[model samples]
Target: MADSVPKASLYYYPPSIWCAAVLLCLEEKGYSEEEIDKKVVDLSKGENYALSFLRLNPKATVPTLVAPLEKTLSAEVESRFKALTETKTIIEFLDKSRSAFSRTNTTSSAPAPALAPATIAFTTVSNSIIDLLHSDEAHPGAARWYNARDEATLAKICPSLQAFFAAKRDAIAASLAESEKGAIQASAKTKKFWEDKSTAASEFAQLFGDGEKPESELSPEAKAKREEYFNTAKLVWETNLRNVLTRLSKEMIGPHALGDQLSLADLHLGAWLARLVTLAGGDISDKGDVAIGKLEKHIGNGFALPKDFQWTPARRDDTSEVKPVVQSKLAAFWDAVRERPSWKKVYANGLH
Candidate 1:
């Protein structure tokens, strides 16, 4: 029998924001679950560190897509696979690969809507917005990781974070034990990989997980390191994220990132904003001032509306005037994307 063609697979974690972005794009592109395999790499258990997965994605990150190259997408030829390790790249690949006109997409009854912008101006805007959302300074995922603003919030998050660290430590220890058995132990590279991971995980657990000490109980060195981490987290939300939101409000062309048509920018922005909302302890269902208030409390800054923006006036009896409403541009964008079936499906369980 001839060698079987390799099927495409996505290695992802459920609560990952970037994974959610790719998942949302996949849904929007009209892909069924059967078309592509979904493989969950459990981050809590350090499954990403497994040698098999590491061979695919050296970075040990989720949302990795293993797909056959276009030239190799034939049964007659041996298939060559490539790992798309970045979320934005994976989304773009998914968007471009599934159009109705593509030879591989014969079953689609209608054309998949182009997610990439059609014009240069829109393309520039879309790329810029996507870059900003994924920037290190404005990273919502890191912000969520270091989110413990007050005693009340710290208490709420510590238990889960501790559990996560404990699982990671245990998993790494198991891997180390397995690495020491048999001929595999002779490979220095493999041995170092587990040892390096073990050391890093232990350091992290000490600082943020199992070895976390009370403020007064911490050594001066440990105290300073912890304080620096917390301060950096605070700075990210107060400065970088706050500024990013301001830029989004001004740059957005209303309803969507670039007018009426949904583009790649919308996919990234929607996922990024959803994460920010969740980090603020707010729900995606939150609207207007309620949403703003929750974000403000979390970021420790006022979310300013445009200067010329007017609030809807209060309703009066026997009048045709609509009831007063409060909303910002970001809130409008959130509301617009939240209505999509793609968004609903990705977040069916809850906002990550």
Candidate 2:
């Protein structure tokens, strides 16, 4: 009889940064699409907040992996599963589960590339970099909060953000209505879940949605609150993200974050940087300097590479004094990561 191995299901949204990280990890580890069931949760429609999905992940975040329990591996017991909700946990599971000696390596003939650092020192550096990238201040999603600098940009961005929140709010309202009308009443727990989601959505819509008046015509209090939100976001980006980038540049050894070899840190950094690049209006195809320039423009004047960092000097003329060229190890890391097959495949649709 054919083996009755239970397959895992990956719940993800294509445009999510951490989802992209998990997807990249799967590709890098040689997990074929057929090996795992891939389910897309539409965040725009608030599918993540549905009672069914929330049962699997109370936080309603992706990418979540539902893996078969070890006891079920023998095929004697009915299949039991567990959910992995965090990106770091998911990546570690994928790496260790598919290693050369792992029984789960049945799908691939070649040994999976070792992504974890082999040495203690390299491992320390790798973990630290990964933590930095995942920090709240460096989160790529926050890029949208402060990306618009002037009136023209806000005019374009505000409406889109408003629309996004409006859709989510409407979706949550629909779900709540449906539950209320169901023949079998939702359990108290389920009812509370829907109510909580509905309240949160309404609040977000109020804060982010455009009302009858355009933003410019809004009351002074309203305008000030909105301005303060964006200002705080910008401050967080300037202080935290700049520090994160500077640390990455200084810690990087070369082509990758740790050195020549790709480590777990590279996977997290690659996905995070790609999202930042796209949010900053830079294309995945942009050269290192071009991408860096776009990010600097978005971040304003305070963002700069470390002053003491070495760079090849350029001279305007033979008699002219040399000027340090704009370059960064962070950018070099980006250039290297974008060239990987896994990156190309995961981002084939577009950077998210």
lDDT of 2 by residue, 1-352 (tens): 1247788889999988999999889888888666788999988778887768878998888999999876676666688999999899899988888876665625655548979889999988888888888888787766765565455565566666777667777876776777778943557777676677677667556656543346768778778766776676667667777777778877777568887788788899888888888878888788777887787666767676643333554567889878655457766677778888999998897777
lDDT of candidate model 1 versus the reference:
0.77
Candidate 1 lDDT, 161-207, residue by residue in tens: 76776677778687677776752342577657667877766766666
Candidate 2: where are CA atoms >4 Å away?
A: 1-3, 181-197, 211-216, 307-326
Model 1: residues with Cα > 4 Å off, grouped in runs? 1-6, 105-111, 183-197, 209-214, 305-326
Checking candidate 2 for backbone clashes, the offending pairs are: none
Report every candidate's CA lDDT. Answer: 0.77, 0.77
